[model samples]
Target chain A: MSEQLATVTGLYGLLAEFREPEQVVAAARAARSAGYRRLDAYSPQPVEGLAEAIGHRTSRVALLVLVGGVVGCLSGFALQYWTMGVAYPINVAGRPLNSWPAWVPVMFELTVLCGALAAVLGMLGLNGLPMPYHPLFHVRRFEAATRNRFFLCIEARDPLFDREATQSFLERQKPLEVYEVPW
Target chain B: MTPPDHVATQAAAHSSVQPPDAPPPVLEPGHTLSTVTDKISSIVLTAPPPRSWYFGLAISFALVMLLMWTITQLLWRGVGIWGINIPVGWGFDIVNFVWWIGIGHAGTLISAILLLLRQTWRTSINRFAEAMTLFAVACAGLYPLLHMGRPWFFYWLIPYPNTMGLWPQFRSPLVWDVFAVSTYASVSLLFWYVGLIPDLATLRDRSRHRLGRKVYGMLAMGWRGSALHWHRYETAYLLLAGLATPLVISVHTVVSFDFAVGQVPGWHTTIFPPYFVAGAIFSGFAMVVTLAVPLRAVYGLQDFITERHLDNMAKIMLATGWIVAYGYAMEAFLSWYSGSPPEEYVLVNRMFGPYRYQYWALLACNIAVPQLMWSRTVRRTGWMLFIVSILINVGMWQERYIIVVTSLHRDFLPSSWGMYHGTKWDWSMFAGTIGLFLALLFVFLRLLPMISIFEMRTLVEEEKHVHGGHSDTSDPRGPAP
Candidate 1:
């Protein structure tokens, strides 16, 4: 129901193309300052501070990694304790059933294993990847986004968006070309 | 392979600039973002592999066949088919395992440690180094599983519940090794895959082949280089690097614990953990040199993997070699300082026993030979470093052999002592694993972008920005279409 306007508009966004990364970044910052929301910028390589310019704050990736590491730590120790001390106790050299020293290596390994997995997987999930079909790919020149060019896209879903106003605004930003992202 | 310095001189001859005293560029100059992407991705996308690649892979594949045959025979017959016997139960199998595992350390050091240290130069070699780590670990893993005698029941090492009411002995260092090694391999893979994603996307986008595009696209997980995605990816990559640093250290330490925890006079050393880790890095860099020299030459990638990279890697090998040499000195010093007759004999017997020649050879190869690296000229000369790296590889293997065989063959009881020798099966198994390692590496080079394309692009941008070269718009390829 909410995307009904977008459906009527028959578009994803207006993409502004630029030769230099600084151009796209500045344009994205300008659009955001002019009260545009739901925008993204793409570049051939990571452009420093571009995400922030496009209305994203600090990413949750690190926090999620921290949570994953904690979960791995607790579970790793729990598995060892339950297996060794509670479930199948083995008395060796008169040591206690719950010998924590012996558990360190496996626990450490699991913490790292689970933590590393979390870092990669969490980043992927947050990014909404495996999205093989994206409207941006429809722009033939958009292929250059992964090569040598940079782009700023202003989605039609933004409240401030108007077909004419947005296109003209993107043009005013001095893009090489402003593309209508036909959905 | 054309010598790297020769390539460097040629590239320099082409450029004909830069003051004499200035440091060599990590990446050769004249690369724009597009140019860097094109050069790297073209290898996977357009450039046909050279004939030498095929010839090398054919040899490696044949060796892989040899490995398969060796494994089949071992499984059919039993542990008895090999020469491992009473005193030297752990011969080529354990020695090769340690050597291969140690060889993986430099990759982790290059990828995770160098990344953390902000070593921008690592960008060119990190991808293949990480891949090398995965393959080396794979090769190392085979020896232990095959040596288990009953390879089919190898799952018994895992700490899972069973009807028989058995659990892995948690206290054993062997059990700890199981956890450590598996964790290291998986983490290394994840790290490698995560690193590869952006480059895979470049391959996907650049690929004209239908099948290649689909395969790379799936692996890339639709990475479109959105600023948001790169932000998350950078964070995740940094976090993984942080976790991998300690994990790499712990892996070798755990491997060393397998010997240190044992009561064998020579094996039970206090310095084993640090010494083993040092030796691991030493051998690992040697292997990296062995791989990198040919890689740059065959692919004409001297522009990316410059002489500076070679010089830096050689410097690291020299530094770690000194650490290993110090470990040898301390180990001998402790032997006499303890005044323990058996411990002292272990050292003396290593020098005077039947295997005394191997001990001196080990010293000469590991200790004396690498001393050539002290010369700046030798370190920069590609072939000399290559020879040194090979010798170090051999010397490190002999160190492990001596540590495992020499100590076990002549234990406390003189009457119980017996000479041990590796049968053909042992040598075949060792050579076979090398084949397996090389075959995996060959396939990786052919299929994937050996250098990270996006990272190289980023490095170019950073270099440009640092020198205020960003506004200069004379791209040889011209503005993107």
Candidate 2:
């Protein structure tokens, strides 16, 4: 069963370690130029131009927040209007049933509330987070990526992925080491 | 590998690119990325609690017990247990409520607003400040519930489905508060949690104990430092900050509305929104300093929470303290200029009324003591700043007491006017919340990475960029167009 599982997951990628962010970035750029599209880089901290080099820049979280905010704003106003104007219309100082002024505070609160919620949830969803398992965790040295090292991984799923060629290509970038990441 | 001296030279050259007026160093000198991770994570992951932590915890837990006793007595007796009367309906309860809520603002300002402004110094303090916001808000939240008289019926504030088919009065600022405070607490929690993720991952990775790793791993949600993940994380964080910025402004404005909407001479003022917001930030920064000064000492976190952090925080307190001073001046000016006999009377009463000492004390602490912060020596001296912070907090509490009690104790109808004096219950509840806040803080320090490891790592990386010509490849998003 374990062997079957390994075959199913197989060798997911060739992971390369670079001593510096510049090295990994240059390697990413080089790989991109070499027409490798299914590549990702990791660094201890954000390295400029690396994301663009590996080509995964745009995020929809902002747009999601906007939608959430609009929904919240409308819902907030609607809730107040439905309750005060329509549902239970009690006269308070002869004020109009549709008291738009009083509704503003709750509306603003909900807008911020929903917008923030969507931002966090959208980020996690887009990143596919809460994912405890990844093929890279199987690599003993991959932990350094969170500490000080830089890494670039070319996934086996890439149409152009040939293990030997990918390994040789990564080696030419003068990376610290290269290893296969097993799923 | 590059020679260590060469790397140093590059970093020194990079420092030149920083604007001459750039703020003081965030992290102490000579910290490598590995060392930074080790130092911060070690506090939670490895080190045993110091004697001070236990001493502080014991005191805090005692206070928590006192708080529980007070609540039990109050619940058994009633709101009569408080010093609040018909004329002074909102006494220490409302005073502490507003004071705590105000103290929460600095955290959001530091974490959300400073992040938006690209102030890197915030990195050092944001984690701590955000945690402060949550705990402070927790303390603030207890007041309105307890003050409701029927604390269990607090759910009536929500517009939930009911057999009577009733809804919370949307027109009331009290109801507005229900939304504002809850939303503020929720968003702050989310913002704090989201910020903790990467740091939690750091802790998860660094923990040698099986239990520590498992706990941190669950909290980290399997973060693997993927660039793609960081990209989305940054965007979400920026969005949350943007959302929270308006919130920090709005929450206090709504809190102010609780008074401003009233017809009382002192309570109804156009300036309340900005005035209250400034006071909130003022008190909140002071509270941050009060917590941070001792915390840095006890934990030996000077390397990360650095002298620069205290200096900058003191400067913030001074700036906001001026704003608060301005608020006082404006309130008095508006009262006199308007020539409303009642407004003029209220202002005069605040100056010479029965609680006149409190008003003066407020000025002494909030306005006068903070003036010392103008001198660089006072701002740089941690103990001096700590003392000033304590004074500011006292002054702020007095400010709220004056606002709530002075305004309510004497209204337009002199016949109904009555003075307020806090009972033991009032002091107990206040002291209890303080204990609860401290106890929660102690636990937080023991478990979480109080200093944001990833952000400090980023700061280190940026510094390296300066020295190494690594700036070119530092931000993939490219230089701002």
Candidate 3:
């Protein structure tokens, strides 16, 4: 593989979106056909076929939750065993060395604590919360994502992300307007 | 091009004042008592009562009052009037406390969790569930206060720096209950308030009387529904929902700590928290169904709280019922597996002991009976569903009693064992609590709009926006466009 450190400057990508979901889908298909890979789409709400247009599988949220729960369960068991059996083992009324029964409540509680913590932290981590900064924020009308606007963006990161080619593809979509993004 | 300009010009020509592009102004024989009553009457007249609604309400109200008077007498005389003795000091009070608290959990789940999930059907039932939660919690909060014997010094439960340099023991489960219940109530109130503001605005816009306008205007908080305001409001509501979802689970988990961390054989277990939470939600749904089934008929909100809503609540009850069943099975399994003689005995007594009837009642109500709802037809039938809900509530209450009273009745030593038989006062006090809960609910029904108007409007708006120009049959989702 020839790892050429290619650098290009003074190149900007423009994004335009159609109000109709079908039009957005058609434009996305056209862009992909036009070899634009580094693209993103935003809608006020989740559109039926937009996930396929963006070319991503199901969200990684479930994976995060699964990993969190497993880790939580393990730590819960480990912590209770360590505290009760090893740390300060007070043999109260001839209870066993590995007293699993006594450990039950704390283990359960810690499991919930860790599982809940994982959900909060995992959600934040996945969503990139407290982000305060994003290139999308630079777009004046991007605030409409929470309201009544649908949008699509083609980043300059894709191998075929040529400024002129991306702009031409978006213009053919016949959206409200096409704007250049300075990332 | 400008609709407002045309309307304004037309109003000027007619010599009648009308705000252009604004909602119609409310005008009538406004401020007088008769006018206000008339306005209320119009809404009431259109309201259709169920065939047997009056009988149900009268009975529930009567029983509730009986419970209240019983409690009042218990509070006045002393905690000694009950049959709780020796090891079984908890008896009916603690059992009732946990029972009521569990009944309160479903309300929060419907409002907060469903809101976060973007479940639109939640709008119809959420308001009544929330009101149920507040009232049930009020009922739940009482048992612990009265159970404390000297209820007046309940202020000491609040953690504070005192003149005598005393601070509450945060480590204790009872202390945790104080914080948990207080925080739950306060947050639940905030959640209810935030959801109500938009509906209040709708009421304000629709009011035709001066008192109606004044009352709703104050509640509406001068909302103009600007895009930015809606944006911020949605964000805030979502954020609050996020906060509340875990809080619901946590509050009940903490409540379970009162039992699970104890040294008692039946009480000490890992499954109690989830078990308790599940049972709470199960009972809560049953209570909501108990209230809403008749309410929709009485209030003429069949379009709002349709059979679909009843079907959903019944499904939820069934789901939670499975959880309760699983928890009970696990407890029995753990007891047998643990190889602890005392734990083994505790499980045995629970199944076939003196209070075996209570145990079977719980199993039948919380687990077996709800299975009938698996058939959609039964769930959709209001009277059938209502009967099941009432039974579930009874079973859940008895389950709590069995857990708290029966377990503690024979603790640590066999010599200290004592069977708890509630006196007449005990029964009356329990009855009194029902009355108090209903009285609060009665006032709430009259004062507030029982159904959420704003959430309904949002659903309508979303429907319109999605199918702007398409044929009704074109939409793939349920009920088409």
The TM-score values for the models, in the order shown, are: 0.95, 0.93, 0.66
The DockQ values of the predictions, listed in order, are 0.83, 0.72, 0.02
**What's the TM for model 3?**
0.66
Candidate 1 wrong stretches, greater than 4 Å: B1-21, B469-481
RMSD in order of candidates: 5.6, 5.6, 15.3
lDDT of 3: 0.69
lDDT of 1 by residue, B71-165 (tens): 99999999898889988899899999999999998999999999999999999999999999999999999889988999889999997879998
Docking class of 2: medium
Interface RMSD of every predicted model, in angstroms: 1.0, 1.0, 11.3
Question: For every model in order, what is the number of clashing pairs?
Answer: 0, 9, 11
How many Å off is the CA of B339 in candidate 3?
A: 1.3
The best candidate by DockQ is 1
Q: What TM-score does candidate 2 reach?
A: 0.93
Please provide, for model 3 over B1-481, each residue's C-alpha lDDT reduced to its tens digit, 9 standing for 90 to 100. Answer: 7999999986564453333433211111012222222233334233343445455557668877687676667678888888878888888888888888877888999998998888778876888788888888988898888888888899988644567655554335776677667667766776787677655654554556678767766775554332223433454456556656877887788889899879898999999999999988989999999998877777665656777788888988999999999999999999899898988988889889998999998999888899999987788889999999999999998888888877888776898888888888788877777877776776666567676655654454455554454424432232312
DockQ of 1: 0.83
Models ranked on DockQ: 1, 2, 3
